[model samples]
Target: MVVSVKRDLYGNGRLVKASDLSLGPRQCMPSSQSTATSVIFQQGLQDCGNTLQMTSDWLIYSTNLTYSPTPSRNSPIIRTNSAVILIRCYYLRHGNVSSNAIKPTWIPFSSTISVEERLSFSLKLMNDDWSAPQTSTVFTLGDIFHIEASVDTTNHVPMKIFVDSCVATLSPDATSSPRYEIITQNGCLLDGKQEDSSSAFRSPRPTPDRLQFTVDAFRFVGSDNSMIYITCNLRAVAENQVPDPMNKACSFSKSTNLWTAMEGTSGICSCCDSMTCATAGQSRRFGSLYPGHSRIGKREADPVKHWLLLQEHKVTTLGPLLVISTEQSQARTVTPLSSLVQLWVVVAFVSLSLVILTIFGIVGKRPFKLHCRKAGLK
Candidate 1:
């Protein structure tokens, strides 16, 4: 009996196209009417056409091509020759190109990516000349101050930049000033220098590696005697080899935090409470990068969390704090002197005045005596 069997077509693995695989019948034993059997199989292959592929082992017989043979009641058959499928991201489903194909599975990159490799930034207070202040190191209320920021080469691909101001210390009234503001924000690009659009989402130009801004101390505080902390937050991304339009290239992979300090003291009364910080964009090189797609918004990240994570991430930069005083405070002598030195200066001044008075009294008496003698002689 020439028994034939057709294997099951459905499988769990990825199926290869007939062109990718070399398909041929398994060798069979020579028997009666072998030519007829071959002709029947060849006809079936032709009917299936170019699209059909033989993945599993199939048996052919002259007795019946369509008939499915079951195991004899006395004998059970164990069949083996299953196909292995390797599912890939580029495969087309059911030979349909119009329909969306299998998408590449994205695995989240290591959240522990080193901050240095991802992005870096710095904050500096500059003078009108754009040079570091030499004499006026402290920021005074009403004083026009300039600030400069530069990012590391790795993190120059930022999508948004933010400057947040807050009172680093608790006030006597048990209140704290913490405010968040967007300095430069655009969907996938940085704000242009000349663009006047009020919308924070528009980017008329490319992002720069360095940026600058000018701020008036009094205007920033609205009121005086508070320590202010300004931090820079940057949202950055990393990309993959293959790009797609149906979805983003990749999600935001890094966050960079750079900060500087300023103090608003009573002498230089500040309007920090009422005054807001100033911002500007400088020229820097920018490359095409993936747009931000994280659940975290541009300005919605928790300040407390960011502050806490700075230490954990080991990404914070330390620098001296700039003191901001009101014009009144600057005029007042805040220099401290030793009590002994002050007392000694007072005693020395009193002694010098008394000596001068005694000398004048002696000289006047001598002159008067001489006049009396001359009159008596006359």
Candidate 2:
């Protein structure tokens, strides 16, 4: 019985094909030998017209695998293992154009995929405008374009895409003159709560109900220096679902490029002459706890009284007007009256005690002792 066999063949015997040992869907016996693996890739390219004349491409790669092997003495094998790979690529187009003159644009495009094939695709330009037949196209100043790309993750597999670099070239164009002024406007409400609402000042949490406004003004100038003015009117309505009798209006202006509220005639002119303005004012008037008096106890008598005063003084000439009404209840001081009553009570009790002590003292001092004596002893 001295017949020695190969240690690997002692447990099992099998043959495996290299092509069958993939990371895909397949299984094998201990000695049969099997493995599975797959890879996916994606890429994007872009080309812009005169503003951005160049070609760029990026890459993304991913892979996964699983393998199992039988243990053997002569050819020892591990149990099981899995592996994965991920990669990303980025390409930028470069040319001899100046940096200032290049205005690049990026647009995304979609890709097609097949079920059996590993996910892989490229974004190509549909029009020849992005690429030149002979040399790469050149972009000129003040030009705009689009770029496109797509992912075949249609297979519903977890995958990642990366953007490497984006480049563009620019060159001067006689006919490529700049035009159109850029104008931006923003509005906001502040119902005793939040402030600005623009992305520049957004909070993760919900803000108090308020209106916000912002404006950006731009214009192209040829030779002569000039000034431009912009005007805007803003109004706010309470969404509380309750009927409100108050009027809420906000008027704003920018002079010397500064934002300010509009008041009367003079203030109106200031805002009307500015290039940018934000008109924001509150309409909901708050009533005072006290009817006739201001919240601070100032004697305005009533809203009519305050209005009359405003009219007489012509305070509206100032920029932006804010009118508020508040009422405060009257409070009387009772400390003095209580102190007077206590002092009177203490005085009366002391006077009565002194009178009783005087009467007792007089009676105790009287020498009314009666003594009887015999005539003979005397």
Candidate 3:
């Protein structure tokens, strides 16, 4: 993120020069913070460098206000405290040169910055190239659906999102009955084991916040031409954490003779064969979709519980994707009528009615005229 200062920012009726402002730990003039040069009267600072950002390369950084200790990026934040990244930029309106780079008359200008904590989740259906969203929701049997599930916490800490479970249901409610479980037991791809199935995750993920997968489309055996909604349970963790059995996406690979993970460390996928990848004794509790809690780093007396914070999760759904067989699709196509076709049908009916009425009028008049001629002859 870019940090900038205005040129005309004045103190005591004097303009603040660019070199007078310093950022980072020392707060010394001409601060040597590499994180992009501070914007000012140079290179159109009005556009790009007007606002100050609190992040450097996606990680939040902070500088001390009291001490000249080195700038640190590591700090613990809990529920008691706000999730703010403190930054201090020294603007020495009046200072003197000294043996040390720091000025004795330096003044500290501090700003408290915090990222948004709210998170949003969604599941999307993509087309072949994954470049665009699928326009047509109708899919014939044996077709494939390219799915992407993600969590969005725009300015919050970076997180690695995982699809804990994915099940297709006729209803929007994920817990509904007559469900077809595709990915279950905390990221195991059950459908991937089927014969001739191409269901698995798209490897080389673009980001940990999004997961891509392909599922061969099909409907419930007895339910044909039905609407199916795919609801997936997605969870997220800190990006720095490692992918464990519960948080990794695993797919069965027939060619490799072992289960594989998209995030690597295939050893975590070994239990996928037995469908026991979830943590021991932690069964999926449908009693509550959101069982645990939202606050991640609570200030608890129990240290162990603090470190083992519960990850955030959301149940995101995408579909009403029409599932139909080839025969059904063909029948629907033949029976469907466009507005133009319907308008033509109405026009034809009106014209036929007018022709029939004209013919009847001519026939009735001819009979009357013939009778009148007979009477005249008599």
| Residue 9, model 2, lDDT | 24
* lDDT of candidate 2 over 1-378, digit per residue (tens): 011112232234443223222221122112232222221111121111101121223332211122234455577665433221111123343422346664444322112211222433232222223332211112222211112222333332333221111111111221233422111222211111113211111121121122222212122244221122111221212123221221221222222332222112223223223322233111123244344444633565454445323211100000011111111111123566678899999999999999999998877655332122333332
lDDT of each: 0.32, 0.25, 0.63
Cand. 1 Cα-lDDT: 0.32
Q: Count of backbone clashes for each model?
A: 20, 38, 0
Per-model TM against the reference = 0.28, 0.13, 0.52
Off by over 4 Å in 3: 1-116, 280-310, 330-378
TM-score of 2: 0.13
User: For candidate 3, what is the TM-score?
Assistant: 0.52
**Candidate 1 vs candidate 3, lDDT winner:** 3
Arrange candidates by TM-score, highest first: which order? 3, 1, 2
Candidate 2 residue runs with Cα over 4 Å from true position: 1-57, 65-78, 87-378
Model 2: lDDT to the true structure: 0.25
